[model samples]
Target chain A: MSERLEEICSIELPTGESVGVHRRRFTGGLGPHVAIVAGIRGDTPEGTRVAHAVARHLSTHHERLCGTVDVYPCVNPLAAHHGARHWPGFDLDLNRRFPGRADGHAPDRVARTLLDATRAADMVIELRGAHPAFREETQAHVRHDQPVALERALRANVRVVWRRSAELQGTGTLAAELPGLICLEGGVGNRLTDGVGLELCDGVLNLLVVAGVLPEDALPFHWAAIQRPLVATDEDIVRVRATRGGLFLPSGRMWGEVEVGTPLGEVVDPIAGETLEMITAPVAGRVLAMREQPVVYPGSLVARLVAT
Target chain B: MSVVFRLEAPYRGEYALHRLTFGGNGPAAVAMVAGLHGNEVNGIQALNLVAGMLRVMRPKRPVHLLPCVNSIGADEARKRWPFDDRDINAAFPGDPEGAPVERIAAAVMDATDAELCIDVHSGATTVREHPHARVPLSGPELEHARAMMLPVVWRRRGDRYEGGLVGAWRGAGREALQVRGGRGLALDMDDATTLARGLVRLLAHLGLISHQDTGTPSHDTDHVQDYRSMAGGFFVPEVQTGERVVSGKLLGLVRNPLGGEPIEEIRAHKAGMVLAVRVYPMVHAQELVVRIAEDAT
Candidate 1:
């Protein structure tokens, strides 16, 4: 097995500064090809960490690799450069420009190039970033219609495998363009969370094993050590929103169990120092995500629960 | 001027959407909105100019002017709402009981009820736009836009107005158009005056005001072509917006900033008026450098 670093494309800025989006390719004996992409958003550093962690492991076990595995540590280098959600000057969200125009602007061209590069892979896994306002449990998301993707995500070492509605993915998203794509996201946006990188890294290795890119015996840990994730459909997940506008104090623990009416959080007036409303769980489930940014408007999402 | 709507903001005093009214109240001759985007100062300026003109004159019918909708954003030099960073324009036909932006959008919708509605805007901070009216290819809107006699009358497809305030008004069975000029975050007096003149012309055309028509006729066309840089480089434009150019005119040059090497030369394709020009030099690949409103002939 041999590994080669390849540049997908180089983008020249107005200052004649050139930056390249790169991928590390590990090629072994011919078999199924798997691609791991991360950092579509600059704020999602957790995904970037997980992408590199998996690449480091792949480098050590290249001899045992059965096929080719491509790891794109960070796709949007420009956004990542500024730690911003959107491209700096354009203020355009890169994730929303997928299957983009080849002859169009930088973001569109890069989107088109990335989409074309990964479309033919046997398995494509996207490492997504958490919304900056929320701290999420390690989770896997796939389209509800994609049973194969749903089944594959079960071993992703996540707390929940959310099979979302078609429309929920939104148009112009990476998941919408790529059929049978599995998206993994965790931690807080822009900040790295402890244990998330390790867990997701292990999950990727396990996925590669499932995809025949690596042998089961080559996994650093036993296959049985992986978490048995909860497979949830769109209907099973309920979004908890604040009824009153205030600063939210999250009381729910990540992946913690809950019964109906359990206290999840409270909304407090920032100026008056008074409690406005107490948010409680409406279903018997586990806390999947919690808003960490505190500021909330009426109808603002405070948390999400995956009903058991 | 009166506060048409208000939202209780926890941190700030409160978010107020104000409206300036003119003439006796009945069905309005027209409704004009500006500063939907906080940084688009030209819109705010043009609307204020119109208000000044209307204050002394008695209109046959009522006319409404919203000078600065996103006042908080304008105060902070941000394009969106300061606290949440949400675009107010996107929340059109919005819910009164929804988010702050949504409620503000709903209020604007409720307040801007008129025979004809015009949403005014400025180009982005990085680009300067000439005063122009964007209307449908063929409608009462196109005719009204013609009456404005702005520098350019851009006829666009209906689908293009599917999102913003203009779309919301059109969806409610009202004729709507957009008037844009100058650049965001800065004021250009000439472009603002041009926009104000166009609004005054529209009022005269509607018999709401007995104003004189003195502005030049607009370059009417449906062919507004955008020229994008093939590569990222420092762009130096040679022509100012509102300037006329014949076929194959040298418009701009994309130059390497590190060394003084020229990477690409951009030129006009046909006879037209420059509708927009990139102001900020630093740009990425494929970014819009210029937009031309091609002559009808």
Candidate 2:
């Protein structure tokens, strides 16, 4: 186990000032290698923290592990320096430059390097945090056609496992490149929340156990404690948007259950303090995400509800 | 109106790049393109206004007007292609076999091959820009830019030209320049009129159009300076774009949004014409708030 664990790849930055990409490898006998990546975007600190939590548990139970687990805690270091969403100076989004050119600038070169490194892994798992404007519930996203990924996400301790169409995903992203990849995201953006990180950390560990990378007994928490996630499709998730542009004051909490016509939030005129519109739940479901940022545009998403 | 280029768009009809040509067309020269970004409607209006004037007058050489290149994005009021959010400007000298936006870029590049190319644009949605010409210091292009009779002729370092449409045109061995005015998403009739007049003056300078005294060429100093915010806060500008400022003048103030207390006072370091001003209040640390082009002595 110790011999196999020494094969992690770590690439230094071009500035010769930093380590850009760090990979931690854990291997037992070796059957199928799986990779877990987080913090492609600097604003997604929750994923980085969760990656570290999983790494800590894996280090203690290295002997019982099978195959290999490659963990990349932070991919975009320069952007992470100031907790920016995009790479500074270039102002490029690293995720949107995948399959990037080697001869290109700093961001493009980093994207190319990361893509080349992860291409050979048997299974790829990308971890991310919610958008900075909203607080999201724990969820696992898999491509609709990837039944194998769907099965794996079911065992990942999340409340709802969503199978989304590839068309709904953005181009040049990691998931777009790897169709079968399972993407796990939760918690708030830029900041880490208690219990959310630990739960997602456990979910990744449980998936590792299910993939035969780690033994069932090696897990710190009992398998019964993991939530049996409900499977949902893209159509089952409903987005609630504010009809008017104003200060949105949310009443519904994250992951709170609600029925149709329930008051979710209100858009009040900032200057006059008059209620412009009342945002209500459109379907009987649980709140997937709620806008944390008060200021919003006319079509700005205020909340998302997942139908049971 | 002639169809200069045609591009196929997904989930929508084909996009046509129309050209309004004027005069008897002796030596073909000077092509102007605007609205590559759909939200930049000021340039589109300016080009259309120029086209309307050119239709009545006859000139020696040909002038091609590409009023709106990103027609589909203009329909949705988006800066980039809505099908896949892509900036057509970034896809310069583009690929024919690429995506929808890239194909459009390629078509425009192929269609607008002329002696001189002017890529017209409005400022970003968050900022308002004065009518100005951006050119390199000490060159024939700089002299040509000066003849435009715009409010500001900013002679910048050539190294600043990279990855943009003008840069790509220069790389392809064509003389290219950029003219900017007004703000994005909104049309300023006065700014658009100024830009249209500047284009006419540029055409007259090129011997393509005949005009009686297109204002004495502002033999302005080629010097320009940028004003950047020192801290992240809500920026409140005291001066508007195109306003002449003296040294030691208050350009704007950066105030903390939470407490409404002034964090930093941005003062003009040099006496110049305010070429640009940040319209959006919320600013990040070190972002460009104003750009001042020093007036000729």
Candidate 3:
């Protein structure tokens, strides 16, 4: 077994310079192939971190692997370069350009190249970060209809496994192109959180093992350390919104259990100390995501709760 | 102008949704909205023009005109909210306690509670569109659009009414339609004037304004064909908006940006009136170059 690095595509910049999308491949005893993709949007640095973490572990244990593992870290290098959510010049979300045009712009071309390269893989895992506006709990999202993906996602070692509806999936997304795809994400966007990187890193490695890309004995940590996640459907989730426009001060911790009518947050005047409204849970549940950015208007989502 | 909704802008002063009222004896009989997309200036100007007419010729029925909903976005010449980059139109049936844009949307929804509602807008910044009314294939809204007598009356399917203020209004059981013209970030005087006249004609048709002459719609199309560039380059339109064309007519050409070579020549497929033409020259592959409203048989 050995490791090899390859350039999937190079995006030509306006100034004649170019940025390369690189793939780190680990090939061992032939079995099933798995690809871990990250950084379709520049803001999701957490995904990039987990990708590198998985790569670091596989680098040392590639010799004892059962199959091949391809880690594509920071596919949108140009966007990642400026920490933008979309390609700077075109203002296009790379994730929304999947199954892209062969003769399109650099972003579309890169999307096409990455899609074409990973289409043949047995398992596809997309690593992402929480929306920039919130701090989310560690979770794995699998299309509700994909039982095989849902069954495999259970071993991702996350706090929750969400079975999302197929309609909720945006068109041209990599997951939409590849059925049975598993998406793992959590933590604050752009900025990495404590323990989140390591948790997600372990999650990816466990997924690779589940896909037979790597041997279980090669795991850096014991398998028993992974926490079994609560499986939830769309109906099990509750969204709590702010009723007043002001600053949102969250009272609850991420992934903490709460009863109905429990205080979730408070919206207060930015200038004065007067509280505008107290947002409370409408149902007994656990906080899956909490708004991090404070400024709010009426109907702004303050927190998302997963029903108990 | 009355402040229907107000919210504090983070560092900036504050955001206000203003509505100009006329012939206010009772509930609003007609509601007209513009500036939902901040960069679409033609709608804003057209609504203002209607407001000017209402100032002199007092309407028989109550009318509500929201001339500039996204004032901040208009100030910055942005299509979406400047602060969060959210499309105000997309936040329809808005939450009163939601985000600033959503709150604004909710406020606009509440403010425009009328018997007949119209959401006015302009085409994308990259394209120029002739003054037109887009409504459901067969409904009261389509009749209202016919009364408006815009240059092009596009009868589309209900499925196309998925989001935005018009959809939101329709979802809430209101008869709603959309009026589009000109180009975003730029105001075409003729298109704006046409939109303004159409609104006046609609008021007349509703018996709110006296003795208004309704002009006929130049083109009524249910079959609009969109033409796209096969290659990425500088798009040069051979025809202008509102120009009548035959099948295989030269609609546009995509030329190599570097060497000035013709990469691909785009031609019309059906004999119709050119409803839209690309204004911005630089285009990507598969980008819309021209749209023609096909002649009715």
Candidate 4:
């Protein structure tokens, strides 16, 4: 076991200031190299925290590992510096600048450098947090056609393993770049939640063990302690939105099962304090996400559900 | 006034685009367009103000005024197309049979076919901007920009004109200029009036309109510099827009919102006019704090 951190790249801003991107490598013997990346968007601090946690555990037990494990805790350090969602001066979403140019601006150079560093890995895993306005249940997302990713995501100790079509996913995202990549996300954005970081850390470690990069006995917890997730498809997931603009008060809890037409929340006028409407679940399912922020627009998504 | 184009909306009624033409017409002259992004109401206000002036006066050459292009977005106070959230300015020289915003861009481009064009805009939501003209350094466009007699005529580099409406106009063989003022989603009456007067001055310089008091054109420096923040925090700015500054001057200070510890100090790099300043100061690291236009020696 060695304690070594490699500085992969450094991006120099227009003002002659720079930020370093560091990657930790755990190598035992030779097999397929697996890369774990997180915190592409600075608002998702949970991903960075989980990546560091997994790296810390892997460093202690690196001697028993088989394949190499590379962990990039935070890719966009400048954005992370201020807890912002986009690159600072550019006001650009870094994830959207994939396959970037080396000779371009600072953000482009950083994207190009990160892409180059991870291109050679046999498997890639991206960790993210829920949007800033909502809290999500721990889940793993895999492309429906990627059988390998679907099989690997089952061991991530998440509550729901969603296999969705690639077209449904947004363009220029990390998952869009790597077709079969597993994306694990939970918790709230910009702020850390209780127990979410540890849960995601354990999931990544379990994934590393399942990939034969880390030995089973090296895991901090027993294999039986892992949660068996309910595997689902795109059709089994439903998004519930509010029709009125107001404060959305969610009555449901994350990952809690409910019957059809169950009362999920109420939208009330923030000033008048009058209940405008009551939002209800359309089908019997488990609440996958609910709005944490009170204020909402008319088309704002209030909850996500995993149907039975 | 002519109805150049019309588009149908899903729930709302149809939108009609108006183009006002002046003069029996000599050689086709400048085409003035504004309100490409609907939330930039100052541009629309300035164009309309120019339109009112054009009604009383006659020009020696032809001038086309496209006052408001994205009326739907303007109605909702949105910067982009309300339907698809697409920026009309980005889809320039657009397809006639494309999406709603693209079709609007194509129609606007077709309507404003002239020798020279000027696209007017306001600043983004948070910042207030002085009436200024932006053009590439050392060109005919820069000369036209200087003739406007606006407060700040910024001769910027070609690289800064990437993928915008003005860029697309230049790409299509028309000498294009970009004029900016006020702020988005709201109208600054004085800035809009100043910009309107500047447009009249540019038209008179092109022999399109004859009006006195175009004023003695100030030959300002073409060199411009940007000032950026050093750290991430709530920035408290000490300077206002269009204020003159010397070297080592304090532009703003980044302080911790909770405990009020000074995180960083933003200072002017050179002696110049503060053309732009950060108004809403919840800033991230390396964000732009001030942009200065250095006076030519």
Q: Which candidate is the best by lDDT?
A: 1
Report every candidate's CA lDDT.
0.90, 0.81, 0.88, 0.82
* Model 1 interface CAPRI class: medium
Quick one: best TM-score, which candidate? 1
What's the best-to-worst order under TM-score?
Answer: 1, 3, 4, 2
Candidate 4 lDDT by residue in tens digits, B1-297: 998987644234456788988876565587889888899999999999998988888777778999888887898998877655568897887866554566778888898889999999998876778788988887898888888888898877888886778888888999999999888888889889989988998888877777886465643667777665555567788898778889899988888766778878888778888777767776655556677888786
For residue B238, model 1's alpha carbon misses the true position, in angstroms, by 1.5
| Ordering by DockQ | 1, 3, 4, 2
- Per-residue accuracy of model 2 over A103-213 as CA lDDT, tens digit each: 555566677777887788878899999988889889999999999999999988998899999977766798988888899998888989788899899999999988878
- What's the TM-score of chain B for every model shown? 0.98, 0.93, 0.98, 0.94
Question: For model 2 chain B, where is the 10-residue window of minimal lDDT?
Answer: B6-15
Pairs in steric clash, model 3? A297-B98, A298-B97, A298-B98, A299-B97, A299-B98, A300-B98
Full-model lDDT, candidate 2? 0.81
Q: Pick by DockQ: which candidate is best? A: 1
A1-308 per-residue lDDT for model 1 (tens digits): 89999999787777867889999999999999999999998888898999999989899989998889999998899999888888777887888898898888878888999999999998999998688888999999999999999889999989889999888897788899997999999988899999988888899999999998899998999999999999888899988988777789999998999999999999988899699899999999999999999988766779999999
Selected candidate, larger TM-score, 1 vs 3: 1
Full candidate order by lDDT, most accurate first: 1, 3, 4, 2
lDDT of 3 by residue, B1-297 (tens): 899988766445578889999985888899999998899999999999999999988888789999999999999999888767788997888977666788889999999999999999999998999989999999898888888888889999999998889999999999999999999989899999999999999998888878557476658889998887765688889999989999999998888777778889998889999899989888865667899999987
Instruction: List chain A TM-scores, every candidate, in order.
Output: 0.98, 0.94, 0.98, 0.97
